[model samples]
Target: MWHIWTLDDWEKNIDLERSGHRCGLRLRFDKEVDSEVRRACKEFAVFLRREYFFPIRVVIYVKARERIIAMDGDKCCGIFWCMPDDYTIEPYIRLAAGDYEKLCKKWGKDSALTNILLCMAHELTHYFQWINSIKLTPIGKERQATNYADYVLEDYAETREHP
Candidate 1:
């Protein structure tokens, strides 16, 4: 059920930044996903490029699971993870597809997409923390990511609400 995207899978219209989007994104989906999921993920990729200033290829594993939030390794592997920690270089993001559906049911389609966007932002925060964890304790890293996710989500909502 996992799919990989290289140059072969690159869509012509996909917006990869020139100067900063350095990471070669390798993706693995537990099942088929939509264009919005891909798009939301690319936003995270862009964030990584602009923020970290390093070229680290990352694999994202999207899965359909019940009641589980997203995780960025060092945590429970969701439903369909096969490999161990060795495969975690640049580390893979495990996103909860069921959570997306829950957002849709509770809010709406737009809200669901935004929820995924925030989740992506959240996981990206984890990646940065994981890489530069020397300056941060375990609790501090989690706190930073959580605060970052909340701040980004609020900013995003405000932008959409006004614009």
Candidate 2:
């Protein structure tokens, strides 16, 4: 969970002690992750707190990059049905980079940064669902997250300059 914020990880929490707009969400990643993905993680947390009222900790790591773009590793709370204290967001950083390269070739206009931002946004959408009480079928879940990502990307792009 978010308590995985070791002393090293807790370094980011310094911002939490600041005056205004400090996010409760904590994002941690391994050295294997690149700078771009790291920046995206920070920005995504800010977006959630500001736009959607979700101030949750999200740990991003690179233990796996083969099977999926990203997966939320927060298992069900053992005693109850709620999510645990922190959210484990295992973003397949290398895989996202690969997807960005391939998608860039096919799309011809989007940048590597935007493509990966989309991936991160998609995973965060799942996070939003996990914290809420709504339930959906497998296909329904995918559609909701995809739609949430698409709408947020388009709207946020139009409204502000995203990193």
Candidate 3:
């Protein structure tokens, strides 16, 4: 069972009052997740939203399972679901913590938390592209998202190192 998250549920609502994007972030996590995973995601979501404005309000659902079938029926780390024509419908990003851990091990990521940030960054990039009406072939979009994710992670690393 899922419910709207609150300040008592691990992370406080991100203070986007001055962001000027009229955006908000809502998060829901399955009961199976540990606090560590939730914390990493919440923190990274804040960083993403602050650095790259959300085109609209967004919800992020972190699933417990290791894998999920995308609309195309392919297993993936995460997905950004949106209908380009209907901005009124709140878009959401779905990520699986188990899959993040597995991918971290498989791809030699620094850690699962880092993998989580990278995957979410990828999905968020897709969200931006969708809202901005950027058209690309499927492969091209994937490449762009991948590049954006890398850039985000690198930028995040810089912030941590300097601050």
Who wins the TM-score comparison? 3
Query: Per-residue lDDT of 24-113 in model 2, one digit per residue for the tens?
Result: 445545555555556665675576557654434444332223234223643311101123333333211222342434444676433555
Best by lDDT: 3
Which of the two candidates, 1 or 3, achieves a greater TM-score against the reference?
Answer: 3
The residue ranges of model 3 lying beyond 4 angstroms of the native Cα positions read 1-22, 100-109, 161-163
Every candidate's CA RMSD: 10.6, 10.3, 9.6
Q: Could you give candidate 3's per-residue lDDT for residues 25-107 as a string of tens digits?
A: 66899988757778777777677667655546888888987866799998988999987666556789998777655665686
lDDT of 1 by residue, 1-163 (tens): 3111111222232234643334554556656556565666555555545434323455667665543443453333232222332223345577765566566679887777766666655665665444332256768756766677777666555544521
Each model's backbone clash number: 0, 1, 0
Clashes by residue pair, model 1 = none
TM-score for candidate 1, residues paired by index:
0.56
List clashing residue pairs in candidate 2: 2-86
Ranking by TM-score: 3, 1, 2
TM-score of each prediction: 0.56, 0.54, 0.76
Q: Global CA lDDT of candidate 2, please?
A: 0.47
